[model samples]
Target: MRNTPLIEAFKENEQDLIRFLIVRLKSAFAAQDLAQELYLRVCGLDESFAVRNGRAYLFRMASNLAIDHLRREARQAELRDELQTFFGDEAEVATPEEALISRNELERLERAMAELPPLSRRIFYLSRFEQKSQREIAALVGLSPTAVFKHLRRVIDYLAAVRDT
Candidate 1:
């Protein structure tokens, strides 16, 4: 407690840290969240930890957090794109007939999914709806990641064929 210079440094540079994160993250809301996270991390550090420069350490942590946030966002976007590509485009507006056709297709797709083996269906659900990575699904199902991907591909191909007809 007597030698916690990092806390003093953090108090002096808190606003500057927020501004720095905002520039890196491009959102004031995200920046504020990251700043709060940074503070929590600093608070968790051992009291006897040595640091030559606390401000530098804080800014570096902020930068790394921003990068990690961006990476997670990118991964989510990729997942969305994968699903969008699989399901095809969505029309913002649709006529009654078109809506009915889409609903029918959705029902058919659901039926086709039900026809799949339980493991394949589970993998598909985990990957698509849960937004889990293939490795994560594999770990859950006790299969290799490659096997999980194969399951997803098989189900997707089957669903596509069913949707076409």
Candidate 2:
């Protein structure tokens, strides 16, 4: 019923929603694509939609979008692999191990970040990488300073876990 709350909730989860889709879809470029798709779906939502839990509905839309993406990727990869096999003689050489390693690490970070509960991950990224202060990020993302600090601690713990791997 409250458009203000709906908009606020949507904005708060937007980054993580995009991140989740992009990571699963394996292309940050697709982030915009998926976001647009989500908006298209959400725009059609109605009165009953307004009354139910907004976050769950939004995520259900996201989850369905993700499924479609995964199916498309599977089909594309299969066709690409087959095409590459037939064109093996013209195929590019493999990337260097270091390059591959760096790529893997980037993907790993994305995956790890994606694993985090959305709000925690958002605040953590904004603090560490975006260089936002706790107060600034809290104001922007609708969290308290204490919540931001807790998120930072959780991020540190998660990074330590990744390093241990």
Give the C-alpha lDDT of model 2. 0.76
lDDT of each: 0.88, 0.76
Candidate 2 structure quality by residue, lDDT tens digits, 16-94:
8888778777788876788878876665566355535767767777877777677667767887899889778596655
- Total backbone collisions for each predicted model: 0, 0
**Top-lDDT structure, candidate number:** 1
Question: TM-scores for all candidates?
Answer: 0.54, 0.42
Over 70-157, each residue of candidate 1 has an lDDT whose tens digit, in order, gives 8778888998999788767973567899999999999999899889999999999988776678988989999999999889999999
- Top candidate on TM-score is 1
